[model samples]
Structure formats: C-alpha cells, structure tokens
Target: MNTPQQTESIKNLVENIDKGNIVLPEFQRDFVWEIKKTCELFDSIVRDIFIGSIIYGKPTFEITVREIDTRPRKGQGSRRKLKITSFDKGEINQKSQISNFRLILDGQQRATSFYRALKGIDEIWFIAKSEDDLDNEIKTKEYKDRSLEEMLYTFSLQEDEERISIKLSEAYEISKGDMFDEDIKENFFDNLLFVVAMNDAELKDNFRRYKTLCMKLGELFKSELLLSYYLLNMDNEKFALFFERSNSKGIQLNFIDILAAKLYKGFNLRDKIDELESRYPNFKFDREIIVRTISYIVSNGKDIDRNYILSNLNYDHFNLYWDDICKYYNQVLDFLFQEDLAISQNWMPYENMVIPLIIFLRESNQNDFSQMNEWQYEFIKYWYWASILSQRYSSGSNEAILQDSNVLKSIAKGIKITDRVFFTRLKSQIDSYEDIFSYSRKVNVIYKGILNLINYNSMGLTDWNNSSKLSFSKKLEDHHIFPKEYIKQQFKNDEQAISLMDCVANRTLIPKITNIKVGKKKPSRYMTELKASNEKLDSTLKEHLVPTEIVEGLYDEFFNEFIEERAKLIFDLIKKTIIEKEKQIIDQYYLAPRVQGNIKIFATYYSKKLEATLDVDSQKVLLLGESHSVSSAADKAKYTLSGKGDTSTNGWRFWKYIDNNGQERYIDEFRK
Candidate 1:
C-alpha cells in the first residue's frame, strides 16, 4: 500500500498517460480549462513556479475509468478515437499492474492540460530559445500588433534559427533521451545556442553564460522534481471521501461533481443534467437546481442541502422520479411563460423557486396550472408573488423550499394550511412594496418582481407611440422618465437624487424606437410631446404606472416627490389586483385571530420619534397617517437617522412591541 507523496518528471507523466497507466475516473468532470489557462500552466512550468500537486487514488475495488480526451479542439485539428478501458483490483493484481495503474482524483484539469500540451495533442506548444528571441519577436511588425493569446498560439515550430523558437514537444523528446548520447544533447543545445548567438551577441561571446542558459532550457523538460503527486491506497468508499476532501480547498468540487462520482455505478448525474439541458434548450435550468430538486423530492422534502444530496441522493431514487420530475418541470416552464411571470430564465426572480413549484405540480398530479381548480390556481399565483416580493428565496432557500413544499403539498391534498405566519409574511411583503425603491439597472430580485407585477397588470408593456403591446420578441428598453443626464445636471452631487433617478419607480419599459425619441429629454417634455402625438398616450402611461402629473410638473424641483408618488401608484396597482384579489383565500386559510381590545403599539426611535399600531388583520402598521409593513416602516424611520441617508432597514428587528405576556419583543417574534 503505497500511501505516500511522490515526484515524477514531466517526461514520465506524459509517457504514463500515453501508455494508459494513469487514467481519469469515470466521475471526473470534463477538461473545462480554456486554452489561455493551458498556456499559463506551460508558462509557469517553464518558469519553475509551484503549480500544485496532483493526487491519485489506487482503489482496492473495481471502478470505471476512461482515457483522457486528447483530440484537438474543434477546427483546431482532427479528432482521434478514444479507447476507454475498465480495470478491477483482481485484474490489476493478476497482471502485475498495481504499481503502474492509478486513478486521478484531484488536479485532473492540470494533469490533462499538461498531457495535451506536452504531447502536442490539442495545440502545439513552443518555447523561446532565449529572452532576446522573445523580445525580437515582439518587436516584429507581424507580432507587434498581436495580443498575448495570438502570440502564444501563433508561434510555430520553425526550422529557421532566426525565428528563435523550438517546438516544446520536439525539445522534450530530445531532452528525455539519454544524456550520454552526444547527438541528442548536441541537437538540443545547438537549437538553443543558435537562437542565442543570433539574438544576443554579448551572451554568445560569454561561453559559460550561454552554455549554462542552454543547459537549463534543455533540462527543464526532463526535470524529475518538477511535477509532484500524492498516491492514496484505499478502497472505493475511502477513495470517494478522499477525493472529495482533497478537492475541498481552492476551486472546490461542487455537489454535482461529488454526486456524479458517488453514483457512477448506475447513473451519470452530469450527463443526465446535460441531457435535460439539451431537451429543454429554451429553458435555462441550472444544474444545481436540477440536482437539488431531485434531492428534495427523493428525501420527501426532508433536506436538499449539498451534503444530503452528495450522500443520500442515489441512482434508484433519481431513476424513479427523474422522468416525472422532468415532465412536471416542463409544465412549470409553461406556467411561468403563460402567466407572464418570466419570459426568459434570466427574468425569473429566483430560479430555485422552481423546486417548490415542481413539488406542488407533481403532488397535485396536474399536467399544468390549467388543470388546477380556481382555489388551487389562485393559491399558487399568490405563493409565487409572495415568494418573489418577500425575496423569500434569497438566502437559506432550501429550508424555505422545504417549508413551502409541505404547505403546497397539504394544499394539494385538500388540507387547509392555516399558517398565520405565512399570511402575515405575505401581507407584509405586499405592504413593504409601498416604500420600496430598487435600482432598475441592477440585478435585484425585488426589482424584477416589481417589473413582473407591472407586466402582469398591463398584460404587456405597451409602446408609448404605437400603443402596441411589447412581447418577448420585441426589443424593449427600461427608459427613465426623467432622462439620466437631466437628473444628473439638476442634482449634481446628491447621491440620493441620483439613486432616485434610477429607481424602478422612475423607469418604464418602452420599445427601442420610443426610447430613442425620449432620450436625454425631460419627462415633462417627452410626455407632453407623446400626449399630443398619440391619442391613447394617457392610458399607456397609466398601464406603465407612470403618473400623469409628471407631464406638467417641473421635475428638477419635485423629483423626490415624483418618485414617491409613482411608487405609491405601482404599489396600489399590485395591491388592488394581485393582493386584494386573493385576499379572500388568505383570510380563510391563513388569518390569525384579531385582538380587538388589546391593540399592540410598536415604536422605534432613531433621530426622531416614530410610532405605529399593528393592524394584525391587515398585517400592516398605521404609521404617520399611512399604512406600511414593519419592514418598510423601519426603512422610513431610518431615512433621517444618518447623514448617509440609508433607508434599507430590517423593520422587524428595529420595531419593538410588548407581547401578550408583557415581555418586550421585536416585531420579528410574530414571524416565529
């Protein structure tokens, strides 16, 4: 049992790979390193940088293995046939091959990269004989304009000494030959000496200096201490653990990689994911989502975390549920598109939300949302909106998925889910939107949720000029109501003013043509022009939740007020259509008992005094003559607390109230 670290030369490593003694395990991911990375690896090796050690495991049991893909990249060269061979412990022992055979567990990408470059299989590699030669090449007209990538790939194995480069494969072959062979040594050193003599006269005159440099260049390819490795002698179970632990550092192996390796005997998780991707090319299904969904369903929603998926998700469970899950997943996509929640995968507020959605669809045994009854359909819609608006799937999402899946499954079974916390959270999410401001250009889930809501309310965003509804195929732009340049000119150095300029409330989707016409113009100017040109312009602006007052008011003086007014309009629209429409279902299923006489007053003070009455039925705070969720109210309270004018406040934690037992507690306690 050779369980010790070892060293091998680049020459021997490439040879062992060619002889099929060193092979990749069947579970290893494909060589995904780019050509630039391969070039960097070679550059590091030549410069003698520490490139890290490879780790291999010699299993005591049978396992599948494959030959490395030595074929050149497409269009770079022709493809070669790969001969994949399997070996068992018994066969290796019988054939006296135990000393030679090993499965690469770590550094697969690096090892594969070295083999491809050293063997000249993918792209032919080359080395400059001298730095003078490199400098000369860089100064040439042909190479001077080339990028680093072009220079690296363009240098070929030229016979001309003036070119001052040697094929790395040719150099390695000569260097690895017997040093005592005068002809081989002479040929290798002569190539280096010739380039130096032509390029560097001073170094060429100094015989010792030129000879030392030439010998160092020749010895680099055959240096025995260059490539280091560690070998592990272990059984299959230990080998799997060792592989995972070894790769748990930099560029750690993901769950999909570990699961694929563990389930290699009966299934290839990665290949299955690839198949799903190919089958549903229109939908961008993340690989992690697919694996986690499988884990969620197989474990019956007990867990879908990385460790659980790696250890518990097996081939049998995957085989049984995969086809049905795929069917349900397709239906989920159809539902998303049909409901206008997402036109493309990027538009989805949370991609992993698909897990719970799929669970509900599968448990209900429905092909699509069309098969659902009115109550069921409404429940799912509300759930989707609440999930996105609350940013529920933002972090620690697996637990949320499990919780929501159970609630949805119960719904599927005709069980009333009388979860008070769930409805409160839903109502809070709706109320929170009243003061929400999101940077429209950023990757924000809340921003996307608001846009989706607006799209849903409007049927589709309409062109301000033609009044045609925008679709997925049409080019749409989020046009700022007050042009960005105009706002910047007026606000100058005000960060809050600039931020409000880009707020989602101040932006609306219009066709590219409409955007061009509206460019760099004040909203007042554009809206006035639009009103005169288009008869239905007022209705179009209303559809987009844009206030008509912007058409007449001076924006520079009232920009903040305009944003607030428009945000209120957007919030009112979503509340009236989405939230209030589903209020009955929420009231019947998830409402908590209303405390009539014992009304709880929550208060928080920062720079000023603030107070609110908790309306438990509406799940809102009556603060300063306006209704807001605890979160939004907290944000409003924080607006004047700091010179920076930060408004993102976690209201549940900020606002405090006395519980029924006379203990002061945060408003977040109600959620628990």
Candidate 2:
C-alpha cells in the first residue's frame, strides 16, 4: 500500500480498494458521489477518455487510520445506492495497513465512484448505438453541464455476475420514483430507434447495445479510474501541505460552496436555494447574494464576514429564524423592483448594493418598505445614484457596504440617523477619476443608472406624442449628442474622435423616437427647429440634465469645439445632477437638501459697453424684451457686454445664478 507507483492497473486498484488497502485521509469530505456524476465517469471510461489522474499521499510516520465508508450507512436515506452499510467503526478491525495506508489526497470521490462500478456494488451503464457513438459523445459531453440524469443509466448491483449486462426493464424498475422517466429516457431502446420491431435485425441490434457497451466499458472502467497516480511519501509535518498542493491544481471547491456544507447537518441548502430561485420566476438571484444575506441575518445585522459566512452557527436559531431570512430576502426583491432600481438585470451594476439594505431589514424586524421614511428613501435613492456615479460597490466586498450595514441597523430602528458622514471617503476616491468616457467599460452601469435618473427626474420625459410621462416599458438607449455619423464626417482621420463618441458627457438616455428622429443631424440645425416648435421642448431637453450647449448659427466648422465644449458642459451637468441627487441621498449629500423655487434662473453677465441692470425674475433681459431660459438670457447679456455677441457667448456657461440663500454663484462652482 505504501508503494510509490506512478501507475496502477484499473483491476488491481479496484481490488485493492475493495480489500481496504486505500483509505481517505481524515480531512476528506464524505462520499457525496452523485449518481449522475458516477455515470458520467462511466461513460468517459467506456470511451477510454482520460477523465483525470489521482494523488495518493502515504505518511512515512505511523498514524492511526480507519477504513473509508466503502459500505453505505444502513438507515441513511441518501446512501441507498451504496452497499454494505452495516460495517462499524469498531469493526475498524480491518488491520487496514495501519500507518502504511495510502490516503487519497485528490480524486478520492472519483476513485470511489469507479470502484463501486467495478465491484458491482453500484452498476453504472450507458446506452449508445455503437462504440463510435460513445466516442463521439465523450468528445462532446460539455453540453451536460447540469445535473447527471443525462444520457447515462444506473442500475442496482445485486450481484457481480449480472453487473455488466443490465436488462432495460430491470434498470427502470430499480431506479427510484420516476427518475428514469425523463423525456430523453423515453427513447430508452431495446432498439436504437426506440421502435420495437420484434424479430427485426435493427431491433435485435438495440438489445445487444447494453451488453456490448457494458463489456467494452467494463474493460476500460478499471483503466479510466485506474489513472496514473502521483504518489508522495511525506511526514505528518508536511502531509497537509502536500495534500493541499496536490489538490490545488485542479478545480477547487469555492469558499461559498464549502460554507453551504458547513451549515447545520441535513440543511438542504441546494433545495432551499432552488426554492428561493423559483420563488421569483422572473428575477432569480445568484447564490452568493443569498449566502451573504444569510450571513448578515445570522450575525444579527453586523457584517457578512468571510469567516462567519463559512462556519456553522447555532442550528436552533437558524431553524427558528429561517422564515425571517426568506421574508427579508423577498422584501429586498420587492423593494428593488418597486424602486425600479434596475431597468433590467444588466442595469444592476452591483448586487452587493442590496446587502446592506436587506441586512437592515432583517435586523430591524422591518419586512416592508412602509418602514422606510422619506429621508431613508431619499438617502437610499442618493446612495444608489452615488454608488453608480462613484462606482461605490465596484469591488467585490466593499467596506462601505459593511460599514453602512451597521449604520443601517440604527437608521432602520427609526433612530434619528446622524449626518456625520456619507461619501466623504469616496470623494477623494472619486476625485482620482481623471475622466470617465462613455466608452469606458466601467461607465456602463453608471450610465444606465444615470439614464434611470433622467427618465425619473421631475415627472419623467414626454413620450413621442408629448402626451404623457414616458412609460418604463420603453427602452432608452444611449444617444450621442453630436451624432457619431456627423462627427465621423467632421474628423475623418481622427480615430480618437470616433472612440470619444462613448463619452459619458456625450451620451444621454433618450426615447428611441427622439434618438431616431435626431439622427445624423447637426445639433444647431435640428435643435433650433425643435426649440422653436415646442414651447416645452427646451424644458423637456433640460429635464434630461445633459449639457445642452447649442445655439443658432454655430455648427459645421464647430465640430471639434462641440466635443471640447460639450465635455466641459456635460461634466458640469453631472456635478449639477449629483448636487440634486445628493439632496435626495442624505444630510451629508451636499450639506443637506437645498430647496429652490420652481422658477428657473438664467446666468446674466454685465454688458461693459452699457450700464444696464436686468431683472432676473422676469426671465428676460430689458434689451431682448422677452422671457427666456438661461441660455437666451446669456445671449442678451452678451449683447449688453460689448454692444455685440459672438458664437462664443454661451448663456448657460455665462450666467451666475442665485442659490436658495439668494446669494449669486456661477454655474461652474457647482461643477466643483
């Protein structure tokens, strides 16, 4: 058993395992050898495909060891497929090679599965028309990525003599429930076509398949699991290191997967996860979210620390509070959908964003959004947008969420939440961003979040008819301000110009109709028409909060200026949007909410050529003699500047507007 052989014949290995020469190390997990997985290995062995190799670690020092669970546990419901469960730990009387016993550091599960098949303890069989079909299947078996009850078959191994040739009828009988009654299994053939032509040669050919496959597969079965062994003889001090190194090269079990196993015994995490997934037929969450949710709840809403997530907590409490976990999770889903947090799953930049909210809900005993105050809603709203613009949860496990999870517990309790902080730490992190182009991969989620904000801002945008608030059902695609087609024509040789088309400043979410109708047209041309036709069109466009830097009679030659100008303007617009969103977010969101009158302010500059003062409230310049938005206000103000105004005079950029305190400030200050 201590022999350091690189390879062993399949027959010899199986026999040795049956005789208890090979044993699993104490560190190994129990045989959770799935039936379908075993069958898959059987199929590959039949094709003589190299499934994989195994590692056996033998200790140089004497160590006590017990025989592995070759036999099934007698009364355990999950172990029915296993044989001879009646063996006892005391019967560990099998001298078991004592210290010289080889421990399967890797491939223990696989080896045991193949061993069962060869010993006729658990017969694994597959149906194929010929050896060629088996060969073709092994080469293309990646499609069976899910559970095992696939093209292979499994039957009871009552006796070794009958193990190789299983009757189709008996295979069906021995299988539990209607397990063999799958649609694929419906084509189970006494003949290849599944059409029974009694006495037909083709039909007779089908009957030979099981026996033929069994005989051929049985020959390779030993060799398949009989893979080359990487044997190491290490002392106890290095055994663990060698075992880890030996298994590290292969697919390692995920920490989360191990966590699921570490939960209370008999806690069917898989079945529970399936139930939760099926609960939302339309929106299924991934397992990590649920696992984190459980961790948050079990810890009483503190933090989803990795160590806690991977350990088994009190089962009594788990059993007691299980329903509450489901309640909090479902409530989380409902809240996200209610808020329209995501246009679709793709728009959801970070699933981790929901962790803090759900943790608060679970800890606060608050299951519904009704418990959320206006301030909380506003805070959450701001947090959501801030998260996107700042990419707050971009990292897998952000400390902010964990930090917020603790703060949320207090806030959820109707405790007057302190404005001591929010996004301040993120400010420097955010400032580090030199620029975010529309084309940046990181900006995609942020852009989508911006789109949602635009559509929802101030009663949303008007539909094509200008009849009603746009419906959420309609998709708003990223629109180029200076159309890419038109821009391409302007800078034909500049590839960077094309790449800059994705700039966040240049991109805005607009109605498909607006996006299409405005296609391939210079902004000054089409927009002038649009500004003239609809009295509310200016406001509608402004509602978008994008930098609308257009004025009449400036274009064809202004393409480069458009990008540079729009880039600055759009950046300013983002700052302004963040300002407004900050108000909705929390107290720390830009020094609490700054409320202003509905009246729009225009930026007015003094005309040095004339000593004239314009009344700001009228939305008019005395020189212009009419009401105007900020842009028009600037036009008149510029005229007063030098008895003339050039195309360079941008009113939006020019005017200094009053804040809530009635103190005048430039639009540029907010951009800071």
Which candidate number maximizes TM-score? 1
Q: Per-residue CA lDDT of candidate 2, range 1-672, in tens? A: 466546666666666675666776665776765444565565444433445778876554444444455553121231222232223343343443352346688887778776665554554444332111123334233322312223232332211111123432334333313434243234444323233222344334434444344334434433434564334553332233233233455854445555456564846667777776677555566666666666665665544645455444544545565656666767776676556665445445677777777767765665587786676676666566666666555432434566567656655664543323445433311221224343233235565655555554544555422535554456566677778788888767765566566565566655677788887887777676666656566566566553355635364556655556645544554565564455434444344323332333453233132222234333333334555544455556655543554322223235555544333333322221
lDDT of 1 at 153: 22
Candidate 1 clash figure, as a count: 0
What is the alpha-carbon lDDT of model 1 when measured against the actual structure? 0.63
Q: How far out, in Å, is residue 637 in model 2?
A: 72
Those runs of model 2 whose alpha carbons end farther than 4 Å from true positions after fitting are 1-274, 302-307, 313-323, 333-342, 396-398, 416-423, 428-439, 442-445, 456-476, 481-486, 494-496, 510-540, 546-672
**For residues 440-468, what per-residue lDDT tens digits would candidate 1 score against the true structure?**
54366667778777877776767788677
Give the C-alpha miss distance for residue 285 in model 1, angstroms: 1.6
Each model's total of backbone clashes: 0, 9
For model 2, what is the error of residue 332's alpha carbon versus the real structure, in angstroms, after optimal superposition? Answer: 3.9
